[model samples]
Target: MDLCLFVTHNCPLGCSYCYSTPKMDVNMTLETAKKSVDFALSHSHDEFQLSFFGGEPLLMWDLMQKATAYAREKCSEKSIPPVFTVTTNGVLLDEEKCKWLKDQEFHIAVSIDGNDRMHDCCRTYPDGSSSHDDSVRGAKIVQAYYEKFELVSVVTPENVNYLYEGVEYLIKEGFTDITLNPDFYSEWNEAQLDNWTEQFKLIGNLYIDCFRNNSPVRISFIDSKIITHLKNGYEQCDKCRFGLDEMAVAPSGNIYPCERLVGNDTGEHIIGDIYNGFDVQRMVEIKNGNGFASNEECLECELAPRCMNWCHCVNIALTGDMNTTDGIVCFHEKMTIEIADYVGGVLFSEKNPAFMARFYGLR
Candidate 1:
């Protein structure tokens, strides 16, 4: 089981496509955090992932440290191994923080959209000043401590044209693992979608070139598609089982299936709270109400096996109905699969050593 604690609702930066907008000055209580950990451990059999998330989780540094200590103690008592991770906007990540995170063996993900021009398009400070430099500096600092930290890049329509260059720049800056996210709520016209496809193709070419040059990297969007193809469809892990394998706890103690759904800590869509325990009936309703099998169009579609249409959080966030499929997600999956197959085909045909070794287990 994976448990995420929304430690704080205060952020220093004002990102353009931020889902947690209208940020508040709220923080989670240390007692609530410990109880959240205990609640998550009750669901896990052997291992658990405890992650810190927020408007800026690093803002509540003391809470994070205490919560981690409490979780570690609990896990030790329960004989379960606990894994830790944190996703940060990267502005507040300094040397001391990085060193502590490294000592704790926390899996870190730094948010850096791309280069300065591409990044500053959406991620900026309160005064609208450039946060690009600070973000990049933090990423570099994290990289110095951990060789395999994740670099999360959110692609918006404004910076869609720079997708290929953005990824290439990250690779040049020594980031090996990258995840690209699209602002699904943003307006995307046909032209922009077409450009998105082209940019991905350029990225595909870059991916092949990297492997050929002996410096292979992992791009989450592309790697997932290729791996899904290898498996012939989306695996069990690929699909989201809302409130089942993973859950999030808001600063107010309201429980949600995903962190993205915890907007403003509103009581809407809350399954339960730390004090009340999970609403079993409501949880069943939510889990049963969503899936590709529920939608007739998805049932009839040929790509149903590999499509991510069953993600309830994404569907609800974009269309307000978990059962309905959004055109944006449909289009994104199709384009990504097409590009991934193309890239996979080229590398497979050439028998790229690194690709073969990584995917095919060929020594």
Candidate 2:
């Protein structure tokens, strides 16, 4: 089971496209945090993942330290190995925090939108000043400690043109695991969508060049498509199981199916709390009703096997219904597959050793 602890609903940066906006000063108490760990462990049988999430989890740094210690001890008692991870905005990461996180063997994913120009397009301080430099500084500090960490760059319509440049900048900065996430909920007209498609093609070329040069980077958007093709489609383990196998615990101890669904913590999505455990009936209702089985259009589509429309959280975010998805998702998937196939064809024809070995087990 993957238990995500939303340590706080407060953040330092004021990114415009932030879904968890209206950042309040709410924080998780130590007791609630410990209870979250206990609840998750009781449900999980073997290996488990404990992720620290937030409007900014580092805001409640002290609680994180205590909660992590409690979780490690509990996992030891249960004889279950625990995996720790955090998703941060990269501003709070310094040498001290990075070293501590490294010592603990935590997997970190930092949000920095490519380069300063692209990042500052939406991400900024409360005073409307740019946070790009501080973010880059923190990311560099983290790089020095952990051999590899994830860099998540959000792609909005405003920054669509800089997609290739932003990734190029991150690659130059030594970031290996990079994710370019498109803002699906935002309005994307023909012009922006066209630009998005073009930007991806450019990045696809970059991906090819990098692998050929033996300096490959994992860009999730492009890499996932290639992997989907390689796997013949997403495996059962690769898909999101909603509230069944994973759940996000809010600071208020209210449980949500996914972190994206934990907005304000006052919605119908509340499945259970840390104190009482999951509402079994509620869990069933969500898991059954929110899959591809619920959408006839998706089930009939040829691209259904390779598409990402099965993610309930993303569906709910875009269309406010777990059973429905938008044209943006459909369009992006088609473009990604087309580009991935092209890239794969080039690498295969050339018989690139790394590509052949990875996908075909050919030396």
lDDT scores for all predictions? 0.89, 0.87
lDDT digits (tens) for residues 1-363 of candidate 2: 899998888899999988777888888899988888888888899978899998999888888888888999999998988899999998998898888899889999999998988888899987889999999998999988888889999999999988889999999989978998888878998999999999999999998998899787788877788889888888878988689879899989999989888877776688999888889898778866854634677778887878888888888777778878878888888999999889988988989888888778898
Q: Which model scores highest in TM-score? A: 1
Give me the displacement of residue 234 in model 2, in angstroms: 0.7
* Model 2 RMSD vs true structure: 1.4
The TM-score that candidate 2 achieves is 0.97
Segments of candidate 1 deviating more than 4 angstroms = none
- Tens-digit lDDT track of model 1 for 1-363: 899998888899999888788889988999899999989998889979999999999999888999999999999998998899999998999999999999888999999998887888888997889998899999999989997989999988999988888899999999989999888889998899999999989998999999999999999878989888999888777786678888899988899988888878877779898888899987888867856745677778887787888888888887787778788998998988999999999999999999999889996
Q: Pairs clashing in candidate 1?
A: none
lDDT of 2: 0.87
- Report the number of backbone clashes for model 2: 0
